[model samples]
Target chain A: MTVEKISSLQNPRVKQLVKLRDRRPRDEAGVFLIEGFREIRRALEKRVPLRELYYAPEWFLGENEPALIAQAEAAGAQLFELTKSAFAKVAYRERPDGLLAVAPQWKRTLQDLDKIVAGSGGPGRPGSTTPATTSAVGAGAPDLQRAPFILVVEAIEKPGNLGTILRSADAAGCDAVIVCDPVTDIFNPNVVRASTGVLFSVPLVVAESAPVLAWLRAQGVRTIATTPAAEKLYTDADLRGPLAIVMGSEQYGLSEFWLKNCDLPVRIPMAGQADSLNVAMATIITLFEAVRQRAW
Target chain B: MTVEKISSLQNPRVKQLVKLRDRRPRDEAGVFLIEGFREIRRALEKRVPLRELYYAPEWFLGENEPALIAQAEAAGAQLFELTKSAFAKVAYRERPDGLLAVAPQWKRTLQDLDKIVAGSGGPGRPGSTTPATTSAVGAGAPDLQRAPFILVVEAIEKPGNLGTILRSADAAGCDAVIVCDPVTDIFNPNVVRASTGVLFSVPLVVAESAPVLAWLRAQGVRTIATTPAAEKLYTDADLRGPLAIVMGSEQYGLSEFWLKNCDLPVRIPMAGQADSLNVAMATIITLFEAVRQRAW
Candidate 1:
């Protein structure tokens, strides 16, 4: 028998789910969410902690049900159920994916990053005194080579755009993502859903522009700014260098200050009628450009 | 103060608007659509004809109102008034943009492509005998160089992704976009909304894959296929040649048959954990590579 709780839309859990619909809840609770069957399954299978799991009884029932129930029971996840209508209210999309989860935020400190790197089996980071490849670190070695490829989204709006960006970035083997001045919250349910749980895997750093810039500089990283005004095209830029390509918002573009200040300002050339490209596209090209460069 | 003859929600006009919401309407009417304030404004000001426009009288009277009404009227747009709820029903998003319009679908054929090139005073097209050296093509000259760099997409699904790709392609100055096995109509209201009317300006062609592939071959185009399995990096490939970079859907990637049968199979290198870059990003980087190669 399932643990049952019948509650109105005003119930505390439901309210928490509503607040979780946006980014505010994640910041407040130090927890973010994941949704859809595949994503939630990945999180559970990976031994990631789940603070909550909501399923539609009407939609979910199978031989695998007991395992899911036991896993949540084992992890002490707050298990809840809602009728399709009630579940519908909390889900961002009109169709509920039959399962939803709230996973603990992987709050990582700078020292945590350093510790993980030092623990990798490799000699050390490429530039660092210690150098190691990623595979070398798996057996309790600090492999510098396995260090996550960092994706820094300078300024972006539109949850769907951000989600797609993250999903693609994740698929490309990026180590993590740092979103500065994100238009939507990293924890927004839609982002989690759209990213296909890439947000969970990515160590997303949210901060103001200045500190983030400064951090990258301290790391001796190259900052590549994307713009139409630049003379050099993206492919021409040396993307293989430890780089953090900066992308701008939908409207104005990477500010002139960023252009002047960035280590390098590169353009993606236009061959046709429109003056500029979309922010999402710019981010993707910059990312792949780095990939192409690295492969060289 | 508003023309209200198309009063019934079931009116043929309303049905057309709803149908236009889907790509089928775009096909049936042989026209696409645009929504919101600025986009519609530009389209009208550019002498683009409007089949019909829907707006709530009180809503348009609010802020930034006069310019919209005048523009629509001067363009001879058929205007209509709808109850707030009814208008929302016609619009895709829950909230209406205060205005939406249907206009002719843009379909520039391949025959005229040669004509467009002769107009471009600059001989910029790769491998072509003529060069578009200047921006001064006479009335009789074709702007073949209006965009010499062209990208052909095969069976893309998401409208947002297509719109984003167009935006990026526009920034790259891509000549025209030919969608082969298109999943969504290029002129869908959402795609148009996403492209900011760049859709209107960009010469798009919708056709099947086989014919487009044949045409590219006949053009002596170096067709590059982007896939994860390829051994060569995107940068390693010669991008400056007369090329038609064929990129596939984000989900399935370039079809296996497409990859086996096409000219070249190439991959973009990835680091960290991701398998691939987002499609739009991939397109931009791929297109930009050509622009960069040609620039220097």
Candidate 2:
């Protein structure tokens, strides 16, 4: 396939890609920029829809860039060659890897998550005969027997923290991540970079807190809210079962709505003078505790 | 004590305070900026020597600001009142609480730590009658019988990550934090800010890795290095003993020197696509596991 070449810094496409850096344009246009080699690869691997691929030959360092570009092209992505200066204008990092992509924003709602979880053969009950599935069971219409272990985050404000949480969720082999009333854009460039591409690997859904909670209840998933005020220690909570660990923003924890609604409210023991842990750190600790209990 | 008032942003003291925002000035002058009401209070409470306290009357928010200021004054800290504009020029946070301080940078060596640990009535042998001490044994020279559970970090580059680790160390009730061969200053403004003044509340020591490892050996503290490449999982390690959990930077795992010298190498199990976790998050998870095992 012939790659279209664009050298001008003032190119309209470059200007549009630059505009996508801000949240409003990204929201209105329904597209976001994915930069760097790993992120683009992860997006493709996750089957996130790609509209265009831009690469500057001089700055491209990855040995597989040609193969990646070919793969994107085969998947119907329009490929463009960018000049170094032009790429600089559109690139987010100090040292751009000479590759970037404009991908359509994918939205997954609570219903989609419910279907995905239900289709996956939901996590087996403790002491049940059904074998525990360690792999994510989606994309192929999951076998309707596996249980789901979900992470619910309410109003996370920092893109970096959100991304880190996604990485942890991925590492813990969590089924899906539900973002509730996010304060920061899920597709924020920093979030993509911070998650180190785990954002694409993990199944993520965005929805309002009430709807998400209601859906989980319907799905027979227990919701555990983490709050500093909770009397029960996080370790004491039974996390091995089908669980949804709900975490709030660092500045303000779970709203009264969640505190009143969640099945359990637990606190990570804090022996320090500081009242709480960083939200991402707290989420990882909580997620891993479940992982430990499941012996997965 | 009379509170000196300064109104000009051009004031020499204001310029000096602003320069303290950077690491060079902070290191060269042997002092660091402690911002916000809580941080200033924590520093004073920790007995860190304070040279000056700056506050703007117009923006003061904390109800206990007067009491805190009086305490600082009683501790021999010179007090100054700045105009809003002047304070804004020197303040780091967008929503300043109208409080800041210049405190001398405190350094703790392995020897200091050795004395502190030894004085604390170091941890008794397993099955011994000596009860494990839950309190910090410093200030008046701890009874020389308690054992120390420490957290050792090597070459941590980001002030934010380092600060977060310190906060975790405090939360896990680790006796002290030793920053080994650090890339970022322990008293970095961001470290101070990110730690939320836990840097003051937690005893912190900065030393080279060689000396730190040697010191740990001398103190009879088992050194466990965390690396993704390790064969043993962190949970499988015996962490209830007098121990130090050593972690390296994200980009690079523990240096060969550390890896070769550490008593044990362990990895936190990763079950998903992400290779590893953010260093601070990893440290917290590992430390909390120890805390859980110790039942402290």
Pick the DockQ winner. 1
Badly placed stretches (over 4 Å) of model 2 are A1-15, A54-75, A79-99, A119-146, B1-15, B54-100, B119-146
Each candidate's DockQ: 0.44, 0.40
TM-score of predicted model 2?
Answer: 0.83
lDDT of 2 by residue, A89-120 (tens): 99999899999998877666666566656764
What lDDT score goes with residue A231 in model 2?
A: 97
Q: Candidate 1: lDDT of B288?
A: 77
What would the DockQ be for model 1? 0.44
Per-model TM values vs. the true structure: 0.82, 0.83
Q: Is the docking of candidate 1 incorrect, acceptable, medium or high quality?
A: acceptable
Chain A only, candidate 2, TM-score: 0.89
Q: Give per-residue CA lDDT, model 2, range B1-296, as digits (tens).
A: 79889999889999999999888988899888989998887776566677899998788985889898899888778999999999999999889999999887766666756655675554322212333222331222234344578899989999998888888887787777888888999888899988877776666788888888878888788999998889998888888778899999867879999899899999998766646477887898899888877774
Interface RMSD of each: 4.7, 5.0
